[model samples]
Target: MDSPSRRPDRTISAMPQHTPPAPVVNDPATTPSALRRHLARWPTGVAVVTTVVDGRPVGKTINSFHSTSLQPPLVGWCVDHGSSQLDDWLAADGFVVHVLSADQIPLATHFANRSADRFAGIEWTAGLDGMPLLVADVPLRLECRVRHRLPVGDHTYLVGQVVDLTAGPAIPLVLQR
Candidate 1:
């Protein structure tokens, strides 16, 4: 047996050294350009939110449509701040959310154009509160009244309370960046 004082001391240099990992770049994703590009990568269902103002129809193609609640039957979507029809939608008594079918890509494109007449040559019928409901073969339709409006960044978040709904067997249109 070796005496405690006789034991050889282990050199600190013999121990392994761990280097710290490089710090991650704190690039914020909330920037408008970054958000748009990043969010574009995610696929989303397509829809056209329509409302009537002063006896005329107005609508825009939207991919932000989503359900928020079921007990009170709530749904939501966002309109860009630059949209000219924002006031119409905000003042509308109600609006219709027409979930486009997979074959309705042309319709979506038409609505997406800012300078185009969206309702021109399109078939639609007046629904609750005279809101125009696209007559195309959509998979689902929701008639909703304005429930809430929130200003978020460069868009207005519009929450609606569902008043009426219809569903069909058509396949829903999906869009991706």
Candidate 2:
């Protein structure tokens, strides 16, 4: 049975028919400008990447997660080079991805704030890999083990082996910036 607190479903049945078509602006010399144009057209969901780092909860807001391989059940995300949370996550062998519900805006905001100790006063449990499991009410969660790390440009690319997954039909939080 679904939890009583879960948000009522308000999903759209079909894609809006009033959307405009993409414009074609092909210019090899303007690739950099064109790339920025393309990036502005894509939308992505947001999530908080969390784990226990040296017995302390470490988390950061990210929108870079994506499935990499289904055969091996792999997922990946990129962490910026200058993030203080990056060092902590690099030390952790595993971590949890908390797919926050729309109602978790405050939780997301807390983690995004540079001055806030996001985990303080928040209830959580240790996962199988010693990663911190968020206590917030959400529809989906994933626990994954770090399988590989590749440095790309100014970020660290992490490939995680999905160890577990859970879903409960909850609405996901989205990021527009």
Candidate 3:
């Protein structure tokens, strides 16, 4: 019997080629609903990004706050593009990032309200450059000065250089969505 190795008709070109489908290009605006749903799965700590404008205190509750750098101590948070207080926050000399305690959900809710006076019944003190620091017995507080501002999509990313910080024994408030 002739060995199969003696066959010469077979060649590498005898195999069929397969091509992958074109990648899907989805517009960001078209998928925001899904994106939002996906993002809600992530858990984050809550903070009130506070600053003083002129003679009064102003702030907004946010979970977008995070540390950006270690050297020179940088931190950041995002403000909505259409926020009324965006200008005040950008113009302020300094601001404070109050990392709320788990028991301070009321403080977070208070700041989240747009129509309410955030500091009306809340007790707070002035931090660096007289920026309002909510005295909610939080786990951590950072006094920072705006270092950079970048407009991205529907939000303004504000990066601040930490000037001072304080930490407490309280547990931080965490949230999902």
Best by TM-score: 1
Error of 1 at 102 (Å): 0.9
Per-model TM-score on C-alpha atoms = 0.82, 0.76, 0.81
For all candidates in order, the CA lDDT equals 0.90, 0.80, 0.87
Worst 10 residues of 2 by lDDT: 27-36
- 10-119 per-residue lDDT for model 3 (tens digits): 65665677898776687463586878777879999999988988888998999999989999899999998788788887787777999999998988898999864678
Compared with the true structure, the alpha-carbon lDDT of candidate 1 equals 0.90
lDDT of 2 by residue, 1-177 (tens): 768678687777986679686675764535766665666567777788888777777887777888899989998898988886878867888878888887888888888878647787778888866788887777778899999999998799998998998787889987653
> Candidate 1: minimum summed lDDT over ten consecutive residues — where?
9-18
Positional deviation of residue 105's Cα in model 3 after best superposition, in angstroms: 0.9
Order of the predicted models by TM-score, top scorer first: 1, 3, 2
Clashes of 1: 0
Weakest 10 consecutive residues of candidate 3 by summed lDDT: 21-30
Please give the TM-score that candidate 1 achieves against the real structure. 0.82
| Per-residue alpha-carbon lDDT of candidate 1 for residues 1-177, written as tens digits (9 for 90 to 100) | 989899898666555878987765876666778888889999999999999989989999999999999999999999888888888877887789999999999999999888646888899998998899888889999999998999998788999999999999999999888
Error of 1 at 173 (Å): 1.0
